[model samples]
Target: MALKQSFSQKMEQKLSPQQIQLMKLLQVPTMELDQRIKEELEVNPALEEGKEEEEDEFEQEEYEEEIGEDERDFDIDEYLTDDEPAYKTSVSNKSKDDEEKSMPLSSGKTFQELMLSQLNMQKLTEKEVLIATYLIGSLDDAGYLERDLESIVDDLAFSQNVMTTEDELEGVLHYVQELDPPGVGARDLQECLILQMERRQDGDITRYTALKILEDHFDEFVKKHYKKITAKMEISEEDLKDAVHEIIRLNPKPGGSLKSSSKSLQQVVPDFQIVDEDGKLVLSLNGRNAPELKVSQGYKKMLQNYSEGAKLQKKDKEALTFVKSKLDSAKWFIDAIQQRQNTLFSTMTAIMNYQKDYFLTGDDTELRPMILKDIAEIVDLDISTISRVANSKYVQTQYGTFSLKHFFSESLSTDSGEEVSTREVKQILLEAVEDEHKRKPLTDEKLASLLKEKGYNIARRTVAKYREQLNIPVARLRKEL
Candidate 1:
C-alpha cells in the first residue's frame, strides 16, 4: 500500500479594511456624501469637520511628525493590566453643523391623508370605515385599485381582522371613487376614464359621444382605428375627432396629479461643473464634493498626555488605547475621502478631455465611442470603479446637466470604416423619426436605409432596437389620421 501527498501554489488578491471602506465611499454620489459623513461623525468622536485653525495645524510639518511618531510603535497590551480599573471617557457634544438637514413641515395633507379626511366626512359604520380605509391603502401611485375583489376580501379578513365580502368591498369602493380626483379608486384604465367622464354635465353631447366610444369601442380606440370607429358609429369625421380629443383630455393617471400637488419637486444637483474658458475646458468638482475634515484635537492631546507621563497610570493607559483606536479610524476616513476626491477628479477630467469635441461644440454627433474599459485603462483603475463613478455622478456644462454614464457608449463602425459612437447613430435616427411624415410614418426598414445613406451601417432590427430604446413607437402606432 502507498500514500501520496501533493502541494499546489496559486496567487490571490485581498482588500484591506481601509481599501474596502474607500471602495464603498467611492460609490456614493455627492448628494449622499454629506449624510454619510454625518453618520460617521456621530459614530466616531475622534472625527469632526475641520476648523480653519485645525486645517492650518495639519498643514504644519511638526504636528504631522509628532502624530506619526505616536502611531509608529503603539502597543495595546501595555494598557490591559489585571490591577488597573477601566477608565470612563465622557462623550463629546455633537457640533451644530453636524446635525442633519431638517425638512420643513408640510402644511398641506398628503394624498392618503386627504382620502382619509374625505372618508371621515361620510357617516359610515365603523366596519365600513375600516373596509374603506383598507381599499384606499391598496391603491397604487396611479390611483388604480388594481387588487381583485376576492384578494381584497381575503386581505381584509386576514390583515385587518375585519370579516367582509367582495360585494361589501365593491360597494364601499364606489364611494371612495367619488373623491375629488374624480377617478381615485378605479380598477383599470377604462374604468378610470369612465368615472371621470361620468363627472361631466349630464346632457353634454361631446361627453355622451366620448362615453359611448370609450364604453363600446375601447379596444378600437386604443389601437387608433379611427376609420373603423367612424364607420361603425356612423359619426362625422369632425365630430369623431372632437369625441376622441375629449377622451384624450381625461387624466389616465389621477393619482399622479395628487402626488404632484402633495410633494415638492426635487432639483437635480450636479457633482461637477465644466466651463469653456478661451477654448479650454475647465473642470471643477462641486464644492460639496470636497468637505473639510480633521481628526479631533482633544483626542490627540489625550495621547500626548499619556506619552509625556513618567509612569503611566491604569486610567491614562486605557484612555490612550481608546483614543488611539478612534484616531486611527478617523485618519483612515479622512484619507479615504481625499482619495475619493482625487479619483473623481481624475476620472472626470479624462472623460471631459476624451469627449473634448462634444463638450466644446455641444453637438451630440461629435461624441466618440467610449466604454468603462476605455476610461479604466486611461485612469489606471478597475472597470468596476469607473462604472461606480460613471453611474452615480452627474456633470453640468453650458449644454445641460447629464449623468456621467451618458457619455459612454458602445462603438459602431460606419460604411467608411470609421468607428463612431452608437449615441451618434441614435441621435441621427431620432432626428429622422422626428422629421417623419406622421400620416405615413417611416418604418424600421426605411429608417435603417435612411441611416445607411447618412453613413451609419445599422440593420433593420438594430434600428428597431434603437427606436425602442428611444421610446418611439412602431410605425403603425406612430401613424396619425
Candidate 2:
C-alpha cells in the first residue's frame, strides 16, 4: 500500500472571507447602519454622499437608459457584471442611525455624578478616599449598597491591591451615606431612611415615627396594617398619617443613584410604531437608523480602471476578487435589511389586525387568541424566525409600548373543547388577586377553585405557577401580622 499514515491529520476550522462579512453585517442592527457606513468611508476613502440633484439626475438617466429593455424579460443576474460599479439608492428620508448618535455634550451632570463631585469637595485622608471609592462600586442597579462590609473588604483587597477590613469599610460607608442624595451608600432600607432622617435639622416626630416603622413595626407597615400600626405606635390618626407619609418618603432602595455611574440613560427609540389614525391603525418601521450602503465608489472605480487598462496580475486579481466579494456581501446586507423590514411589518401588521379590537379599546379582554405559529403562517416565515424578531423587539401601539413576544401564549382547553390562550386565564387570575381582600389574600387552592368556577379548569399547581409569574408572594408571605 502507498505510504499510509497512522496518525490522522487535523482539519483547520476557518470561515470564508465572504462568510465573515455576512457575520459582521448580521451583528449590526438597522439603527447602527449609518455609523458602519461612515466608518467604511473613513477607512476606504472611495465612498461619497451624492448631492440631491446628482442623485435625481442619475436616477432619470438610468431610467431612460433602460426604456428600450424588455419589460417582462428582466434579468438581474446579467446586469451584475464582473467589473461593474455597485450603487444603492436611498429608499427613505428617515434613517435609523440618528438614535445611535451620542447625546449632546451640553447635558447637565446626573444626580450620582453630583454626589461624587461633592465627595471631592470634602477634606479626607487618602485611605478614606480609597475606601469611599470601593464602597461606591458595590452599589446595585437599584442604587442600594446591599452588600456587607466583609464582601467590600475582599473586593478592595483583590481589585485595588489594598488591604481592608470590615471596620475601615464600615466607617467609609457611614461617611458616603452623609454625601449628597443623603442615603447614597446605605446597606438596607432602614439605614437609608435613618441616614436621611438624621440629616434633617427640624428633629420632628417624623424621625421617631420612621424609627418605629423601620425598627419594630416593619412587618405591619409592609402589609398595610394600619389598625395594628396606630395601636402599637400609640399615635392618633393624624399623627399616624404624618408618620406613614415620612416612612413613605424615605428611599426604599438606597442605591438608586448608582444607575447614573456607568452611562446616561438609553433613549429607547422604538424600531416600529402602530398608531391609531382616525379609526384605522397605521403601522410604520422606524428606518431612521437604516442607511443606504453599497460597494465603495472608489473601490468600484479602481476595479473597473484596472480591468479595462491591463491584464490583471495575481495580486491585482486577488484584490479585485476581495472587492467583488465585499460588494456581493454589501448587496446581500441591503437585501436582508429590506427583507427584515418587510418581515417585521408583515408580522406586526398581522398582530395589529388580529388584536385590532384590543388596540382600539385598550382592553386586555379584547385581545384575540395569538401564537408564534399563527403569526408565522400569516407572514410566511419560520416560527423560530418570528420568535427571534419578537423576543427583543418592541412595538409602540396606541395602547402602550410592549414586547412583540408578549402576544404569544400556549393554548388551554375550555369546557366546549375549544383551545383558548393561557394568557386569558392569567388575566382572570390577576383580576381575582386584584379584587381579593388583602388581609386574607386568596390562596393557590382558592384561586384554582375560582378559576374553575370561571370555567378555566386549571390545576392548583398551574395556578401557583401563574401566581409566581405575576410576582405575587405566597399566602403566608402575603399575610399581615
Candidate 3:
C-alpha cells in the first residue's frame, strides 16, 4: 500500500482551554475550590487575591488598545475593572465559628497500627509477629478477614518465603480476635457476631443464651425464623427477645470503629443556600464558590512600563510575552470562575424552583419529578454540564443540607393520569414500613395493593423494586415477635 493525500473538510466541535477549565471548576465543591484557587495563585504570579481596584475608563481603554484584541480572546482590562459583579458574600457552608477557625487534623492510629500494637504486647515470637502483621493488613474496612486462610498460607510461602500452615495462622488469628474492638479479624458476618458474643459470655443466663443462639442457631437467627428458634431453644418469646437484644447491641463493623478507618472525614460545604422568606424561596451561591480574584496590579504596571519604553529591545519583548502569558492565564481563570458561578446558580435555581413545594413544606411527597435533562433544558446548557453542577454539590435549606443529586428522580404515573416523582412513592413506602405492625409486616404484594388503594398505579414487582431501593428488607426479615 502507498500513502495518498486527499482533501477532506469536516466541521468539529472542540472545547477551548477556558471552557475546559470552567468545566473542571464546575465539578469542584466550595471547599476544594478554595484550595484550587490557592494552587493557581501560587503557580501564576500574575494572579492575586483581594478586591479589584477601580480603574479609569480612559486608562483601561488605552491598556486594551495596547494589548491588541486580535492576539487573544479576552481583554485584560475588563477582568481588572472594579465594575465586575461582587462575587463574595457573607454566608458560608459551615457555622460562623467554623468560618472563623478551621478544625485541627486528627493524630490517631489506624486499625492496622492498633492491631500491631496489641500484637507486640502479646507473647509471640519474631516470625509470628510478621505473620500476624500480614494478617492485620488483610482485614477490610469493616474489620472482616476477607481472604481465606489457605490462600494466606500459600501467599506466605510463595511471596514472603515464610512457610506457614492454615492451623498456624488460625492460632495466631485467635489472639488477634482477642484485641480491642470486638468482632474484628472475623472471617464472615457469622464469625464476626460469634466472636463478639464469645467475648461477652459471662455466667449470666442472658449472656449464655445469646452465645448459644449465635453458636448453634445463627442461621435460624439470621433468617429471622423466631418461632423456629423459640422451639429449638425451648425458650419463651420474652426470653428470646432479651437474648436478641444483647446480640443486636454488638458492633458488626469493629474495624470501622477506628477513627483512622474513615480515610478522610470531609466536612460538607454546601455550594448553595436556600431561604424561605414569607413562603418565598430564595437561593444564594456559597461565598467560597465565587472567591475574590484579580490580575496582579504590579504585573499590569510592568506590562505598561515595558510598552512605554522609548526603544524596544529583544529582552523587553521577551519580558512582555512572559507577562502577557501570565495575565492571559489569570484573566482566563477569573472568567471561568464567573461562568461557573452563573452555571451553578442557574442550574440550582431551576432545581429549587421545580421543587418549590417540597422545599417549602419539607415533605418528600411534595418533590416533583426532575432529571438532568429538565434542568439542562431550563438553563439552556448541555445535559453533562447540568450533571456536573449536580455532582458532589450540596444545598442548604431550612429542612436540612442535601446533595443536588437528591432532587432529581424518575417519574411514575398515578391512576389519575398524573406524573409523580418516584421519590414521593419511596417516601410513602418508608412511612408504611415505619408504621407497620411488627407482628405481621406487609409483603411486597400487600404493599402494592395498599398503594393501588391510594391511587398509585404500582405493581407488586415494582413495589419490591422500590422497597429494595429504600433498603427495606423482605417481610420475613422485617417480622418481629
Model 3 bad stretches (over 4 Å): 1-9, 55-105, 158-161, 259-262
lDDT of 1: 0.81
lDDT of 2 by residue, 348-419 (tens): 888888778877887766666788888889888768667766755778776687777677777888777777
Ranking by TM-score: 3, 1, 2
Candidate 3's displacement at residue 90, Å, is: 10
User: What are the TM-scores, per candidate, against the unseen true structure?
Assistant: 0.85, 0.72, 0.88
TM-score of 2: 0.72
Sort the candidates on lDDT, descending order. Answer: 3, 1, 2
lDDT agreement with native, every candidate: 0.81, 0.66, 0.83
Q: Please give the clash total of every predicted structure, in order.
A: 0, 13, 0
Q: Which ten residues in a row have the lowest lDDT in candidate 1?
A: 82-91
For residues 345-445, what per-residue lDDT tens digits would candidate 1 score against the true structure? 89999999999999999999999999999999999999999988886789999999999989999998988899999999999989998899987899999
In lDDT terms, which candidate is top?
A: 3
Model 2: per-residue Cα lDDT at residue 319: 72
Clash pairs for candidate 3: none
Measure candidate 1: CA RMSD: 7.3
